[model samples]
Target: MPILSKETKAAILGAIHLKTESVDVPEWGDGVTILVSEMSGLARDAFYAKKEGGKVPISQSQADLLLATVVDETGALVLDESDVASLQAQGTAVLDRVVAVAVRLNGMQPAAVEDAVKNSAAAPSGDSGSSSASTSASQ
Candidate 1:
């Protein structure tokens, strides 16, 4: 489902030349820095953050680590370095599933909040007759 492949991301990230710009951090301090094409950066960010796979949410730190890896090999950070290295060395797979649940919840919360607002707004203001009329309309 991703528009960009791993190779593509690596290539794009590699293509970036960081030497041209000074190492100035953004005011927001997002904890990741790289010099790459805007589109490629966006694509890689989206992919690493699991945005391409719907209902998946990645932590900012994880996203930063992924981006750092995608950008500069030296900039990469892996919390479970030994485990990941072992898995990679053995060709094993590691799946983190919580992101999907978080994404789903993130998507659902807004809709639920909106529905609650609408229902509250639709309810008649202290009028029993209107409430009964609305209830009867459903039946």
Candidate 2:
């Protein structure tokens, strides 16, 4: 389901308490591994920290490290948008090259196929004229 929408943005922000002008740390102890909650909070905090100029613009390696750490330590999923965009760009490049080759190959198809089909359907005597002419020519 789509959770992010203009209408739900404010509610989401409110639910996460981003606009509450304060940070509240959830209680952590007693072997309670709130993995999802902690990782999600960390991700959210990282983003908001950048937005608030509390952190620098994350580099590619830094982003990778962050994603790896979150996924490894907390078993959380994370994606770097710019990394995804780069991968998509590379995929499109490959597709475009494939299409170019396909177009060229397709362009060579028509005449050879036409001739092959026509020749294959020809009579054993190779006569395509009138019936009388064909009979005389065959004999």
Candidate 3:
């Protein structure tokens, strides 16, 4: 299960958080339909296109496409190093914004949560302190 090193996992998660992270998509963000259509260029259209007429790749073409498309961001289909660097910069900016928000939120400790955990833990078992036992159940 642990095939990759820590650095590799970080790189993989960083790239994923970059692309899948939500950002304004220009004029297409008006509605779901429009956004879907606009992003369709980066969707499975190429994969399906190959499947349509049996033009599918048989080797490293698949690997090359995966790296090029995700790193290009604009779907320009060019795999130049500068193109990838530009896309990477955009993604990293988004990631930095998200990480900053998380840091700010973690600093803002909610009193209710603190009270629940602190009071409960300081109290005794079966004495209402057990109420602080964390649970995943939903209402």
Candidate 4:
């Protein structure tokens, strides 16, 4: 409902590069196998490699673990709260940019996007209002 188009998702995924790869960890070893991308360590493959069927987002636990815990150079799980916060912030920022860019790329004006967000956030309770709003927005 919050304007989650494929282009938006794809932009975020492409920017995030959510994939399993090795990272450099000087403290433990040379490299560690973990779920990470070029940008941040947010595991999200389903969204990147989505097919025609449906979209499967990353689970909350997975994200928490990936961001909060990183495999050390010695293949040890290390919990770093600061790292978690940083990764979360980076992911959020990327998503925000992707949404903004995607909306513009989809031919939605700034005002229209604002209206769409408002409509989606607090849509009328009744079915009639919802239907009418949807019809109007589509036009």
| Cα lDDT tens digits for candidate 3, 1-139 | 2234685777655443222223343332464111001112344445335446545333333332333333234333334444434334444444344333322322213675477568768986655544454453420
Please give, for residues 1-139, the per-residue lDDT of candidate 1 as tens digits: 2234685777655554321111223432565343221123454354446544455323443333323332234432233333433323321111122222322322334676588679879987775654222333211
Query: In model 3, which residue pairs have backbone atoms overlapping below 3 Å?
Result: none
Q: Which stretches of candidate 3 lie over 4 Å from their true place?
A: 1-42, 55-57, 60-64, 72-139
lDDT digits (tens) for residues 1-139 of candidate 2: 3255698778766653211111121322344321111234465446445546355433432343333222223244434555534423333343333333322332324676577568768746745566442233211
lDDT of 4 by residue, 1-139 (tens): 3334676776655542222334333333456234222223222233233323665343323334454324444434454545545444445444343333323433345787588779888876656533232443431
For lDDT, the strongest prediction is 4
How far off is residue 68 in model 3, in Å?
5.8
Model 4 Cα shift for residue 139 (angstroms): 58
Worst 10 residues of 4 by lDDT: 35-44
Task: State in Å the error of residue 129, model 1.
Answer: 70
lDDT ranking from best candidate downward: 4, 2, 3, 1
Candidate 1 deviant stretches above 4 angstroms: 1-16, 19-49, 58-139
Window of ten residues with lowest summed lDDT in model 3: 32-41
Ranking by TM-score: 4, 3, 1, 2
- Per-candidate Cα lDDT values, in order, are 0.36, 0.38, 0.37, 0.41
TM-score of 2: 0.18
Q: What ranges in model 4 sit over 4 Å off?
A: 1-62, 67-69, 92-139
Best by TM-score: 4
